[model samples]
Target: MWRTPLEQTATAALFLGIIMSQIVGEGSAVKVLSQPGQQVTLLCSYNYEDNTHIPQLSVQWRGPNNQLLCHYIKHKAYQNCTRGYTISYSPSSITLTIQHVHMEDFGAHVCSVSKPHEFSDYSMELARMSEYVTSAPKSGGDQSGSTWTLIIFHTLLSVCM
Candidate 1:
């Protein structure tokens, strides 16, 4: 009967350009499906006419609640990355690695990058399979198949958006 904070944040992110197609090489929305405590990576990549400007770029990763998870500035990740997450950036891409994903980590993730002339940002949704299974209607009706089908459809649709 109630929506999770993750759902609310995802909706807000969509309205705030997080769902928009970015100028990145990869697809705009990256969806990562994982178990409860598996490693997951959210990839944020971009390309520019010039590679020399890569060093001047700044990248940031935010959680589903819009909390700052980590940031890359001056070619180094901020202190937040030292805690449990690892962020690495190359000239063309930035990757945020969640060493051990938890339920709290299952939701929308945002990656924002800014350069001199190009700025790109988008959101990625990370979902857990258990939630999908356990959160279904408990009326003894068969819905797992449909639930997975819907999830896939929406994931593909969001990426294309």
Candidate 2:
């Protein structure tokens, strides 16, 4: 399932999760299984019934622990982008592009927007990934994934012997 080069993300045990958020009112609450050094764009998009109409909008992208990456305000040139991060805007959406992704960059990314008579916010949370794509198994409802993997492996080994 990995499309990028191995050198870019060399951790077989390191799972990175790219939490997808579309109009996420709060944030994308999910685990991580994404590779480092890969670029990811968190988008804040709006869809109007009529494509011809555009609203005055302002946007801010915050990193983990309320770190401000950039902001695009209405009718303003107030620009602030930091290292390894970029922000761009269009009529319909604002995007936060993160480059050279590392462990430090892994966390909740929130996008706040203001418009005519309306205010909203969206978020994207990142974390470690897991081989079990669905959900991690629970041991008495409280066991780690690695422990479960070892248990299953031992069970299989005993059966083969």
Candidate 3:
């Protein structure tokens, strides 16, 4: 099987602090289910102690292969994204939107934000419904029932968060 790049770069720091942990109050190790050609957005949000003015904060969204999709420094947006991807950021959060998701896109996507010595980042995995179902082995019975069960489980996980 092909593997995503594990290069250590500024974006690499994203996996260090948390080692895959989400923001204080959010879901954990979530596998978002979707279909081919569907539009999807991965969001990374952070709450500040106060509405303090930010100075020189930078954010980057990387693909599964550790490819830098887009980078935003201060209020300026960089156009490194050319694979039908778009990125936008606000005071408290940054979002990466995929125009048309493909099978190759079904993997870990990361978002990193930084300023001076402090930084925060997180990653989310996207999987296709058909692929997910086939990879998940059910105890017994039809795949439809197993699929529904997995869907409900994911729903509950989202709700519990």
- Higher-ranked by lDDT: 1 or 2: 1
lDDT of 3 at 65: 88
Order of models, best lDDT first: 1, 3, 2
Pairs in clash, predicted candidate 1: none
What is the Cα root-mean-square deviation between model 3 and the actual structure?
A: 10.9
Query: Which candidate leads the pack in lDDT?
Result: 1
Give the alpha carbon lDDT tens digit for every residue of 1-161 in model 2.
55643422323322222222432334444333355666666666655212665446678889887988887775666667888899988776777877777787788878787777767777666544333334356545776776765464434434433
**Across residues 1-112, which tens digit of lDDT does each residue of candidate 3 receive?**
2132211211122322233335333434545555677666676766541388777688888878888888878746444665688887778777787888887888887778
lDDT, candidate 1, at 133: 29
TM-score of each: 0.60, 0.59, 0.63
After the best TM-score superposition of candidate 1, give how far the Cα of residue 135 lies from its true spot, in angstroms: 19
Better of 2 and 3 by lDDT: 3
lDDT of 2 at 85: 90
**How many clashing pairs per prediction, in order?**
0, 12, 0
Q: Runs in model 3 with CA error above 4 Å?
A: 1-28, 48-50, 75-79, 131-161
Model 3 quality (TM-score): 0.63
How does each model score on lDDT? 0.64, 0.60, 0.61
Q: Could you give candidate 1's per-residue lDDT for residues 65-137 as a string of tens digits?
A: 8888888885454435736799976677678888877788878988887767777776788866433322346
